[model samples]
Each structure stands twice: as C-alpha cells, then as structure tokens.
Target chain A: MKKLSRNQTFMLITIPVLVLFFVFNTLPLIKGFMYSFTNFKGFGSYDMVGIRNYTDLFTDARVGKSYLFTFKFAVLATIVTNVIGLLLALGLNGKIRAKSALRGIYFVPRILGGLVVGYIFGYIFTYILPALGLGSSMLSSTKTAWIAIVIVAAWQAIAQTTLIYISGLQTVPADVYEAGAIDGATGWIQFKELTFPLIIPFFSINLVLSMKDFLMVFDQIMALTKGGPAQSTESISYLIYQNGITGGQFGFQSANAVIFFIVIVAISVFQLNFTSKKEEQL
Target chain B: MNKKNKVAATTNWPVTILLILGCLTVIFPLYMALVIALKKPSEMTNDIAGALSLPKSWSLENFSEAMRVTDFWHSLGYSIMITVVTVVLAILIHSLAGYAIGRCMAKSKFYKFSYLYIVSGMFVPFAILMMPLVKQTAQMGIDNWFGVILCYLVFYMPMNIMLYTGYLKNIPIALEEAATIDGATTWSTYWKVIFPIMKPMHATVAVLTALGTWNDVMTPLVIMSGTGANTLPLAQLTFQTQFGTNYNLAFASYLLALIPILIFYLVCQKQIINGVVNGAVK
Candidate 1:
C-alpha cells in the first residue's frame, strides 16, 4: 500500500467534501444568483428580466412587509434572548443551590424541536392563554403575532444563551466584581464597568448566532400560525419557502433566497465592522 | 425596592428571584404539555385549567391515541432512525474535517478557501436551491431515509465543522507529536490518543447535533413533504390540515415529542454545563 504524505492524504479527504459542498451549496448559489436576474418561472428559460426582479422585490408591498417582519423579529429576539440569556447565565454560574437542576430546567425549552415548540406554544397561546382571554388567536393579530413569536423564541433560546453567558460571566475574574464591591461600586456601576464590557464578545457571538437562527426560523412560524391571522407573521424566509414549495414559484423563491443570502452576509459583515469600529472608538 | 436594602446590597437575591420565576416559566409550559397529554379527553375539555394545575389522572392513553392518529409509533421509529444515523455521521465527518483543518493550518490556500466558502455557504438560504436540491435528490434516488440523512449531513456540516475546527485549534500539537514519536501511526494516534482527549468536545458536538437534528422541522418537512413521511415534526403538523382541530391531542403529541431530548438533556446536564462554562458551545 502506498502511504500518502499527510498533505496528500488531507487533500484527498477534504477535496471530496469541498466538491460535495460545491454541488450542494455553491452551484445552487450560482443558480440562485442567475435566477434573480431572469423571469424564469422555475423550470426552463424565460424573459431575461435583468434587475427587474430585484426592483420588484423591493417595490412589492408584500415582500417588503415580510422583510419588515423579519427585521423586527431578528432584532427583537436578538436583544431579548441575549439579555435574558445573559441574566440567567450570570445568575446560575455564580455560587447557587441546585444550579445544575435549575440549569436543566431552564434548558428544557431549548431541547425541544421548533415544530414541537410551535405546536406546544400554539396550544398554550390558542388554548391555554386564551382560556384566560389573552387573545382569540396568539398568531393572528399583527402586534400580538410578533410578540408571541418573540416570547416563544426567547423561551427556546434562554437555555442556550444562558449557557454562553454563564461561561462569559464565569470567565470574568472574580476580583473585578469583588474589587467593585469593596469600593462600593458593586451596583449598576459594577455591571456597567465590569460585567457589561467583559461580556461584549459573548454578546456579539450570541447576537450573531441568534440573528442567524431567527432569520432562518420556519417551522415554528409554520406550525404556530402558518404566518397567519392575515399573514402578519410572514418572515422573509417563510415567504421564500411559501413561494418555492407550496406556490412552486421556484425561480421567484430561489431569487428571494439569493437576496436573503446577500442581505445576511451584508448584515453580518456590517455588524462585525460596526462593533469592532465602536470598540476602537471606545 | 428599598434604598438601604437595594438590589446590589443583596446577595444574589435579584438573580435568585429571576431564577425562580424563570424556572417556573419553563415549567409551566412543560407541565401543561405533560398533564394534558396524560389526561382523558373528557377531563381535559371539562377542566383544562385544573388538569394543567396537576396530573389529575395519569395514563398512557393520550399518548397511544395521538400516536395512532399521527402514526406515532411508526413516525417516531423513522425519526429515531434518521436522528441517530445523522448524529453518528455528523460526529465522524466533522471530526475528520476539523482535524485536517486544525493540523494543516499552514495549508493556507485550503484554509482560506474553506473559510470563505463554508462561512459564505452558511448564508446561502435554502429556499432558492430547494428546487434544485429537491430535483437533485429525487434524481439521485435518495428520496427516503437516505435523502433525509444526506440533507442532514449537509445541514449540519458547516456549524459542526466550525466548532470542531475551533476546538482542535485549542489543543496543543505537541500532544499528538509525542504520540507520533512513540511509534504511533496516524490512525491509532487519532483513535487511542487524540480521540479520547477530544471526548468532552465529542460530547458537546454530539449533544448539539443530536438535539438540533431531533428539533429540526424544515429539512424533513420540505424534503418529505409527502404523505406518510411521519417525521416527528411532520406528525406535529396537526393544525395545518383541516381536521378535528384536536388541540388537546396535538398538545399531547407535542409533549410526547419533547420526552426523548429532555431525557438526553437531563443525562448530560453536567457535560452541557461544563461545555457552556468552558466556552465550547455555539
């Protein structure tokens, strides 16, 4: 048997993965990009629509509404989940009784599948909460739909984010908080000066991850309201999904997917740059 | 609420109160799921608020019945098969890719290309290419368990690879070098020396993958959007179709859906806590 050099063997293994990635991801990406430029319905050729598709997507009221909803969800869920998660993490990571059990309890929702979360929460919203006269449909009303989605997302996310925050919080030198306490700076001053600044890196990573997951969430939306009452909960990803699958507007949906990809990448880069620049200025 | 006994002067009280409330918040929904699942239909309808308060009567009928309606046993069987296979495959493939990337850091071209490609691929929304992938998978005759597993393999790769790569970087190369000096072959070195060392990491990866795959809905929902696909999430689709509006049964199923992962969560709380505490999580 001819023993391949480490580099040769490494390439042999990874090249196939890269190739598969191209087949599954990169090629499809190219196809998506191309479709965004055309009026292809899904299958074969169509009118070479140029940038009209992009123009239409922005100008169209429905598409824009979904984008607005998505932004609201991503931004809100991102903030709330991180804040609550961080709070939980800090609380639990400290010397506490039954921290393990508490951690387990906090994480139960995170362990659930999105569909199950949607269904279970949908039940609570539609059946349980409404029995107390909360709302007719937890997913139907516009204001309430966003709120419901946020609450549910937060619930599922608390455990995971808390876990991140716990690590971040624990990693902060105990002497910092202790020094603050000794100096009578242990209150909001301590958190602002010590905890907040220290955990920023965790916050950024968690924020990005939370945003990514929130942007991609579909199952909960589908199972919860199917983006309804009156399409009030229709997120950008869901819109693409509806167009692609149920409507079979493959080309249109694919175009939206490509656009979504570009927007996310732009947003991520923008976030990183903005935060890093802010840090430099600080 | 008081000035002298302010929140800061407290010893973890603020955190403790929030922890109590947070634990209750998670428990309430979980309790609702379980109690309602076990309660008789008549009892549930008559006294849901009471049933939710505590288990008035516990039995497996609701579970079995919901299972019957949703093809519960068959669907779970399918789900278990898919999730188990996918988890195994994810650990194996991701470890290899991660090791290669970690050891071959000087392989700049490969690293650069992968960094650009994999991270970029993450932002590639699935909607656009669902059409092509659906077509491709159908063409490849991977339209069953094989199709689902392949989709999971692709879905899971980027994140796991990212994680493994990061983790492998943290380990010292001298550890592996010492093994090599002791006449250890590459395979044995990885298997006996490196693999054992990577256990905590493996546990983290396993928990994440298993939990994530079990919770996934969109992949199977879209891929097997056919009747009889019966993934756990698909079975949770009781609300979508015009049916009995069996909210109670749906909640029953939702509760049941959580059991497997909840068990895993309970079992691995320590590992998960350490993983989170050690900064090993997503």
Candidate 2:
C-alpha cells in the first residue's frame, strides 16, 4: 500500500472532528446569527424583519433587566468566589490537621450537579433560613434573591477556585517565604510582596473562568429562583432558554444571544489581554 | 529561626479556625440535605432547629418515593449512557484532531487555521447557539440522545482539543518520526503509539467531560424535554414543581442525583483536582 502523505494523514485525522464541529457547533452559530435578524419564531411561517429585533432589544425593559441582572450577578459572584477561595486556599495550605481531607471536603460541592445544589440551597433559603428566624425566605424577595443565588454560586464555585489557588500556592517555593522571613517580612507583607506576584497567573485564570462561568449562569437559577420574584434574577442565558425557545420569541432572543455572545467574547479577549500584560510586568 | 517559629505558631490558630468554619459552610448544605432526605414529611417540624435535628426514625421512604415519582432509574440510565458515550467519543476524536493540529499547525497553514477556528468556539456562549441548535437538531430528526451526544462532542471540542494539543506538545516528535521510519502507517502509528502516549490527557478529558455531561441540565432540557427523555439533572428540574414543599422528597431526589458524582469525587478527588487545575491553567 502507498504511504499516506503528511497532509493526507492530517486531513484523515482532523476531517471527522471538523465535520462534527461544523454540523453541531459552527452551523448553529451561523444559523443563529442569520435568524437573529429575521422574525423567526422557532417554527414554521416566519418573515424577515431586518434589524427590528436588534432595535427592540434596546427598548425592551425585560431584555435590559436581564442584561443588568446578569452582569451584576457575574461580577458579584466572581468577586465573592475568588476572595473566599483565596482565603480558604491560604488557610488550607497552612499546617492544618487533615489538610487533604479538608481539601476533599471543600471540593465535594464541585462534583455535585449545579441543579441539585441549587435545589438543596433553595430549600435552605426557603424553609431552613426562615425556620431559623432569619426573616422571610430570601427567594421570596427580589432584593435578596440574587444574594441567595450568589451565595450558592460561591459555595459550589469556591471549591475549584480554591484548588487552583492551592496549586498556585504550592508553586510558590518555600525559599521565597524563608527569604521574606529573613528580611523581617510579616505574614501580610510576605503575602503582599512575594506570594501575590507569584500567583497572579492563577488568580487571573480563576478570575476569567469565574467571570465567564457566572455570566452564563442558568441551572442554578432554574432550580432555585426560576428567574422569579418577578424575573429579577433572570440572567441572559436563562432569558434565552426560557423566553427564546419556549416562549416562541426565537428571533428576538436570538438577537439577545448574539449580543450576549459578543459581550462574552469581548470580556474574554479583554481579560486575557489584560492578564497577560500584567503577568509580563510581574 | 526563633521568630519564624513563633510567627508560624501564632498564625496556626487563626488559619485552623478559619478553615474549620469554611469546612462547616462547605458541608452545611450536604448535611442539611442528608438530614432532610432521611426524614418523613410528618416528622419535619415548622422550626429550622427541628429540621437540623436527625429524624426521629431515619427512614429511606423518601428515597423510595422520590425514585418512583421521578422515574429515577430511567433518568439515571440516560445520564450514565450520555456521560459515558460523550466522554469516550470526546477523548477519541479530540485527541486525534489535537494530535494532527498539535503536530502540523506550525508547518501547515490549513491546519493552523483549523486549530484557530476550532479553539475560537470556546468564547462563543452556548446561548447564541441554543435556539438554532434546537431547530437544527429537530430538522435533522436528532432531537434526542444522539443529538445531545453530538452537541456534547462539539460543545467540548474547543477546550478538549486545546487540552489535548497542549498535552501533545510535551510528547517528543522523534517518537512519531521513528514510528514512521519503521514502516508504520499513520493510522497504526496513531492507534499503537500516539494514542497510548496520550493516556494521561485522555484521563483528564474523560473526567472533565463526564462531570460536565453528568451535571448538565440545559442541553438535555432543550433537546429532549418533550420527548419523555431526561438526564438526571433535567429530571430534577421537570419534577421540581411537583416536589413543591415536600422538602423530604426533594432532598431525597437531590441526593439521588448527587450520589454517583459524590462517589466518583470521593474516589478520585486528587486526580479530579489535578485534572481541573491542569485544564484551567493551560
């Protein structure tokens, strides 16, 4: 048999994967992009409405609210998770008893389904907290509902972030700390000058990831608030899922989705560029 | 040396106390879930303090009832099948594509373009594709398990391919060159040599994909909602309304959905943590 050329071999290996991606990934994106401009209601009998959907997004109160809520939730959740995760990682990395066991316990939340965790926390907010005389259920009020979501999000998310920080902490050689100690650097100063610079990459990784993940938050809202208390906690993704397909607002929500896509892409590019630049300076 | 030891000893108490508190917060929801799940509805009191106490007669009745109501076995099977199939296929196809791209991108323009095109999918939010994908899958008559699996393959492609390609970089090219010199075809070389060499990456990909697939609710909810099919997470959502105020049944069902993942995490937490860190940092 003739030996396959390198190009032939490459094509042979990659073509299948490429086709799969096109059919399931790229084609839908293109189709969605096209559908966004038209009045396609996710089924038969549709007319092209040009840029009406895009224009409507600006005027639509619900769309505006969803965007606002999503951004707020994402930023708050990212900050909360990262701060708690870093603190926990610092604590876990110390000379604590059952360090590995504690690490494992902290990570338990990461493995459970988001939907399940949401439900469990939903119960806690709805019944347990109220029963404990913590006032009314947080889920019952729009003001505090998002806080509940953020808490649950932080609880599940901190596990992985802490693990990442721990790994980052481990990468900081003990000699660095010993040197700092010799220089009479206290814990806070050592952390500020030595530890922080070394783990900036991991911190940035956690930041970008946490931001991205929280921006697309859906399952938790579904299981907990169902985007309720008058849809105050509705995220961009949840809005797309709830109103776009099910509510027969496909074209309109497709427009929302396109904008959502752009926002995510922009944030990711910005974060990556920003973090890489910071890393270089460090 | 004396100062360093004193500093360490002084800090230990605060760090340990903080970690203990963190551990409690992490375990709080799970503990509540377990306690509530084993109780009968009649045994549950109006007060949160009473809810915190162990059941008067720790019963598995809630589990049995939740199983019957949710058709637990069926959804469990679907979840298992979906996760296993997606993980297996993701590793195989992704690694192959990764190998081709990882090896050839520098020297070949098309391969380079393909690599960028595929990896760029990571930034596009799934919300953008959700509507069109639903329509696309329905049109192709694959709005079921096959479609869900196909979506998972593509959904994971960007990250998985990136991971595999990065892992592939550490593999020496001389090994493949030697295989070629020994009368080995690209196919045989890949299957016999490159594939085995990629086992560690394959494990990482498998764990990540399995966890994602198993825990995901959105994909199945969109693709298979009305088809009398459900993954565990989807099933939990569908029956959530029915569970209503029945915290016992709801918690039991949540625990049921959580158990498999919990077991997997407990057994391979170290690997899971390392795999997640590897995925994130790269």
**Best by TM-score, which number?**
2
Our tally of clashes for model 2 stands at 0
Candidate 1 second chain TM:
0.83
Interface RMSD, one decimal, each candidate: 3.3, 1.7
lDDT of 1 by residue, A132-225 (tens): 7665865667778888988888788777788877777767897787666667765678788888888787777787778888887787788777
At residue B175, give the lDDT of candidate 2. 92
lDDT of 1 at A244: 68
Q: Weakest 10 consecutive residues, lDDT, candidate 2 chain B?
A: B3-12
> Candidate 1: lDDT of A276?
77
Candidate 2, residues B132-176, lDDT tens digits: the string is 888888889999998999999999999999998899899998998
In candidate 1 the C-alpha lDDT for residue A261 amounts to 80
Q: What is the TM-score (0 to 1) of chain A in model 2?
A: 0.98
